[model samples]
Target: MEATTTSQPKTISPPISPTFRISGGRRFSNDTSVAYILPSDQDEVKRLKLNHDLWKELMNGLFKSDMHEQLTKGIRVLDVGCGPGWWTLDMAALYPNSQFIGIDMADVFVAQDLPSNVTFEQMNAGTGLEFDDASFDFVFQRFLVMGLSVEQYSSSVTEMKRILKPGGAIEILELINDYSNASPAFARIGSWIHQAMSARGLDSFIADKVSSVLETAGFKNITDVNYDVPIGPWGDESGEMFLSIQKLALPAVKVMVTELTDTTVEEYDKTEEQAYKEALSHQVSTRFRLIYATK
Candidate 1:
């Protein structure tokens, strides 16, 4: 968690206000060469924000830590890869006395109307963050596993440590590589995801290893919470949310996995259709893991 530079935290104003809409779900950003698997446009950003709401509902709250209850005046919080600032906005509304800052690679959907305590900056986490050491009371990251390359994982953990004050909390939530009890079609999609991510120099299996990385980076009292998120039209509301995420990610998944399946784009159409049917049958399950620790 060492700081290599003495640069102050810089807040750059976004050129355009954020806007969102639902479109054909396409992954892979046309704007940047960053090794991300998902697009950075408004539709994808909105989809990601919706995914956050689903997680919050499934977990029963915004955070699992008692520290969240202790949020008071003057507390500083940093959200890494905080797409659209949804979580930050929610937390800011709940804990108005605390200050919340969100940083992401793109400004696709940063809220224009934020509480006084909330603000957002556009930055890449893999590169060093522009913050002094021990600056924040809490650091939060969600679904950034696929956004960073495998080699950048340790440095990202270290960056979190460097920005967190003594006894500060760090919470990471990610979808694990494991898709248990899945039907054949869903399994094929899962396989394609793994291969697709690897092709982009990212690791789909990093969620399980995050705790060890945090430990090595000098974090302590780590706890890992795991949940099986049912995907399909079954399992009520949570399942519906999961199905939405899968469908939104399908277009990008199609491009990335077509070569791996040894099929032309035309031939892959049938595979996607069968996969959609399997996903609707309530037979697929994906594991979501949450790892939290103290610095």
Candidate 2:
């Protein structure tokens, strides 16, 4: 693939001050260390796949940028916090002329014998990104609100900006709200999950505020596109996909949620079971936001 001949001009970015207060800095026992509410295991891979499928259905495309057109024109791309490498691999297959790289805390499900243009690296999102400045034409991140602290979230975007080519496009897709129009069981699960994340110093609602943060990090011409996903079997394919992801994640996260919310394991399990049933009746929904900007 050919690289762009000239770097785009850099713009002046605002200060990187955090607007939200995410809680205490607690760590989780997982491969990523700080991002283990659902832990990096086989179930985690399935969860990533399910999430990818849901996004594919909702966005009707992998990205909202002109990256696909640029891919054929030889634009380099980076997928940050690229769990399981699903997005990286799929994009690589479709755009052979574009070089694609996926980076995460671990290669939990990264495939061997990847396409010639594709690469995978193990790295933490909070620490410095291990790449030179002005390296990529496009940088994409998704679903990191659950893992990164408020400070880290801002810094990580700064890191992303550092690696991006002067006019590179950065796209972030995040789920800001996990509950709306819920039954009692669904509300319990949603409340506990929200409270648990906050107590552990994570922000489950950062999706709505990412555009502003990107602006603070010096991005320009930012655009915010929103999507609402219904949660429940009756909500059709997207809902079923969400339910499958929940089935894998909920069991692993039960201990964390119950301990923080002061609920018995048995009671939590029963509530989750009821919530699953209620989901079939179309009782829950979530909000996702996609913020894209130029560095």
Candidate 3:
């Protein structure tokens, strides 16, 4: 968490209109090189923002990384797979002295009156991170379960390790797509999502394997925390919000999952409806893993 650089943060304007291709009444990334299948339209933006707020509510803060001191003094930070730049923008506001760079394959940058220390870049982290070795004091990525395959995730971990300065911290947050204690209705929905992800070379269950990836990349002092969060009215206010998030998330991936799994749209819709009912009838939960380590 020690400061590695004292460089001033830079500001860059984002593209006002990013390119996208329509699919199944939703919009997705136009870049074929990137493997992320989720839609990048305004609806998707709403879902991502909701998910970010849910995470903040659950974690009680922006991130779990232990680098606030370094960030306060000044350092370079990188946010990989930063869809919509929610996390990056919040962190930038929290640490004005730190320079923030949020990179994503899709051109979904937040182009408002952005802080001078914040910037967004479009790039695929699966191939590699476009930065010098030991260049950043902090590197972060979250919820990239659909964006990268196992090999690509491993490669990105190596890239993150390579770009992190010595004594610097790197944090990753991910979740399993399937829920524990899943009802029959919810199980069907999870099955379709898992199968679709598998067909695309992505593991919806990658949340459990990230610590090993970080270890192989030579990161040290690793901290792996698994949070079992509820997703139903039975669990209270947070659960209610997460339940709402689930409603949006399933539909968000409907276009990709149905197309990839060869499942009829009618069937997906039916199962998804049943899953919501099942969630309310009983308690269903999922685990989110927050892994942080020093390089």
Candidate 4:
């Protein structure tokens, strides 16, 4: 892998600032500029690892964008909202020739010994990216449904387009926030999640509108794909894995959602229990959307 270059002329970023606030025994990024609701503690780290593992297994790779050849040949890459730096670190290892920069609002980066080609920086993508124009060959963001609101997401795409070199590709993967053929229990949980998101000016169903954002940002050759993965044993190994992910994910969001909405901890726990059972009986699955385009 190439050594990480710190003073590249093409790169210009602001000083990093990471701030936090504690709530309900879980630590979270307290920046009021963002509607991010997830905890940033080690328990959340375990959940993220599980989620990343499941995503890799289901997709059969680190990403869905058509960048394998470009990555192998080496290019400058940026990972937005790179929680724990798992994907950035993994991709750097896989494509040793490529340079990777991962950015986030929190300093919760995972690896102590980062690969030479990879560097983790602290900056909130929602506020604005500080990188120079046309600084990167590719930009990738994933699973930020709970972190970015609709307006913030749109502006972030514009910033991504500005930083991407001509003809550079940008890819985003997001959950649709609603389940397919949901049972009552799952539906209830979805309602609470929707209420919580709306209370913060975020759209839980924002994945459906990403194409418009890319188009409005003047990106071309846009391609969007959707995957519905099962949530329980009935759907096989993937389902079992997703079920485990959900078990942790719901609790991760509980501290924030309950605070935002009328939901009580007791009611949330009960619904989650029922939702797990419904997952088995109803064969529920969550939908994910992957959108890619060129600047």
As for candidate 4, its clashing pairs are: none
Q: Lowest-lDDT window of 10 residues in candidate 4?
A: 5-14
C-alpha lDDT values of all predictions = 0.74, 0.75, 0.84, 0.85
Report the number of the highest-lDDT candidate: 4
lDDT of 2 by residue, 5-94 (tens): 211222122222232111222223443335535455555666777788678767776888766668877878999989777788778777
For each candidate in turn, the TM-score is 0.86, 0.86, 0.92, 0.92
The full ranking of all candidates by lDDT, starting with the best, is 4, 3, 2, 1
Model 3 Cα displacement at 291 (Å)? 0.5
In terms of lDDT, model 4 sits at: 0.85
Q: How close is candidate 3 to the true structure, as a TM-score?
A: 0.92
lDDT of 4 by residue, 57-150 (tens): 7777787677889999999999999887778877887889999999987767855567799988888899899999999999999988888888
> How well is each residue in 1-295 modelled by candidate 1, as lDDT tens digits?
1112211222223343333222234434443335555666655665776687688777777776557555855589999988777788778777888999999877754545556998888788877789999999999998877788877777888988998999999999988866788787667767777887887788887898888888888899999998899887776788888888877666555665664445467655676778778877746788988999888
Off by over 4 Å in 1: 1-27, 30-33, 258-263
Q: Look at candidate 2 and give me any clashing residue pairs.
A: 13-218
- The segments of candidate 2 whose C-alpha lies over 4 angstroms from its true place after superposition are 1-36
